[model samples]
Target: MTSIVTIARLGAQADGIADAPGGQIFVPFTLPGERVNVAVSGKKADIVALLDPSPLRVTPPCRHFGDCGGCSIQHLEQQAYRDWKRQNLIDALRARGIEIEVDALVECPPHSRRRAALTARKTEKGLLLGFNAALSHRIVDLEECPVMLPSIVEQLDMLRGLGLLVAQTKEPFRMAVTQSASGLDVATDDSGALEGPARQAAVEYCIANGIARLSVDGEIIVEPKKPVIMIDGVAVIPPPGAFLQAVENAEHVMAKLVVEHLRKAKRVADLFSGIGTFALRLARQSEVHAAEGDAPALAALDRGFRYGDGLKRVTIEKRDLFRRPLTYKELDLKFDGLVFDPPRAGAEDQARQIARSTVQRVAAVSCNPITLARDLSILIEGGYVLKRVVPVDQFLWSSHLETVALLEKPKKRR
Candidate 1:
């Protein structure tokens, strides 16, 4: 049995760090300054008993708090969790000797997640449906997830039952459920392995149960038949697996921040533009070139562009920026500013290319702070100055943090 110890600090993986006799031990579900009896589960340890709980440790809001992998810090006070994420970003940048004001943490409401990919498994007990347990392949059984929107949580039992039926077929499958402004979508595994009657059964079951759209193997078979979400009475239909920011209201907030930063620009290039979320919105005030690698996403953008007035001013291009970054010469037509919403692996070569570009202003949106810091270091070394860094709590309660930054070219020194 491992000796109980006092957790001194919080680690990167949302675990508590304790000083052991020989070295340091990382313990999960134990907060800083908390003395807990731990059971060494594997290479790491788990909290078995809390001898002295930290003042900051509060009862988790969710019933499935420890079991569901969607959130790690639900036990931490809501306000403290926000502060920790803000400090995390600040510390990450400071490690690179970069300095900037981290704006107030934008808090996401509890149970506001609109998109999730839950795993399902057939066990002796029944069908298990939920996120994979932290650092384990075991699927956590969840009656209802607190972090998901109520509409989604309401359908938990139905989803589990469906999963059980699918599992009984002895076929492997995964589900991607998304809640849009209009209705809901349920997508099943589309590896092209399941076909004939079984495939038909899944589709029929979803349609009969009121699933708006059904995708098999990444292809949208059932058109989104639900009523569109109206913004100012304008109906909008987001594409399947399109990069919609997960938080319910954070998308609008992030768009506002980006627009405020790029207000004066006449022309802007939006890289990794998914379904023109920011690009189309930005086009209302400036010309935009929406560059993305995925053909289906671009096609969806093209369709949206045809109908929306704001998108009419935006141009679409399908290019894999990772394989071949846009060079200064390639971007012969100079723009006043640039915006990029890159994936988790933050833009490396693209950031360098932006540094070399003639554009005077740049707005970057990043999901991972470590990669964001690394990319920022490259841009700073190449003579770009970070003006502001805003930490957005898009994925609240989760370890993930999203940030948007404003950068400008520094004056050349003699």
Candidate 2:
């Protein structure tokens, strides 16, 4: 069915929304108050014609803006985009019956994304490597990516050539590329088994092309140079496909908040501490015990701490927090400060334990607002007062939002 409709507002996913005869319809690449003739089907609308354009819409920077899944809110005006992001945090917290003043969205500039996970496949026609298209599995073969660092974008062709040489099947695979102090750290997965000659060619490609390191299926094929990332002042060699803050600016901003919040404490417990992003910095002042499930990530953190100079005692533990959250007794034993940066699901089970702990101060970092809200509500019920909440736009021009929340549990007087 084709009909014209006026977009009322933007939804949580950065798509323009309309209240139709059905429940609701989502139309991508369209802004609020734009009357667009769309092909409607099953609560989704594809804009056939722009009958009216919204004043808030602006010219997008990237040529592949609409086709690429990398960004969604790039067309929206700057101030509007910031408000919409901050409002997302507010709304999420409100849904959990918790109300607080959310700080303004901290903006990140374009061309600063230091990490990217791209799709790749060797096709009969040619090589296809780039981000997946919006709402589809097709790869948008990118000529230029405005959101990623030029360091990564400049080597796309070289990367595709390597992909073609190592590809074992026609089906798609994944390539995770991270920019480090030395050079690019490339990891390929689901590309099938690379036999003897093919693996040799991929290794030669990395060495000849000045690529720092290349790993296939979690195995390092060639490491012409060690891939190192300097966090605060310590250097770390991240494991294959390790988690990193997408943008450098956002990582520094979030780190500053976390470090300052727990600065006064003598002992700190960092749960889900990946690669010691915060623990290494925190160790400059406090005795830190970092726990995580990924053994490789924990090993990297331990190495960074052991080699870092002018730092306090920092210990690493490999523990699956989702399965066994640290109990309140364990936390209260020696730690006065706590920090946990969990995945998108948030740390519900761990938050329950923190609620019962006597850890004086805490810094909660999350990429999902709804899950963060749920955890914060849990901490509040356990007598923790939410002191500050700062929303960071780590994933720029996308639906995702990152938040740094500070909370303090009061001391019992004798």
Best lDDT among the predictions, by candidate number = 2
For residues 182-201, could you state the per-residue lDDT of candidate 2 as single tens digits? 99999999998987999898
Whole-model lDDT values for every prediction: 0.76, 0.93
C-alpha TM-scores of all predictions: 0.92, 0.99
lDDT of 1: 0.76
**Candidate 2: lDDT over CA atoms?**
0.93
lDDT of 1 by residue, 1-414 (tens): 667888988876688888887688888787888999988754478878899988888988777778777788887876777778888898889988888889989888878888888877766676767888886767777777766788888987877765654553443356777886656776666324445676567667777777787666666666537524333223456556555678757877787888888888888888898877787778778888888998777776666666775443778889999887777655537577788889999889898887776677788899998889988898788777889898888887877988988888855568
The candidate scoring highest on TM-score is 2
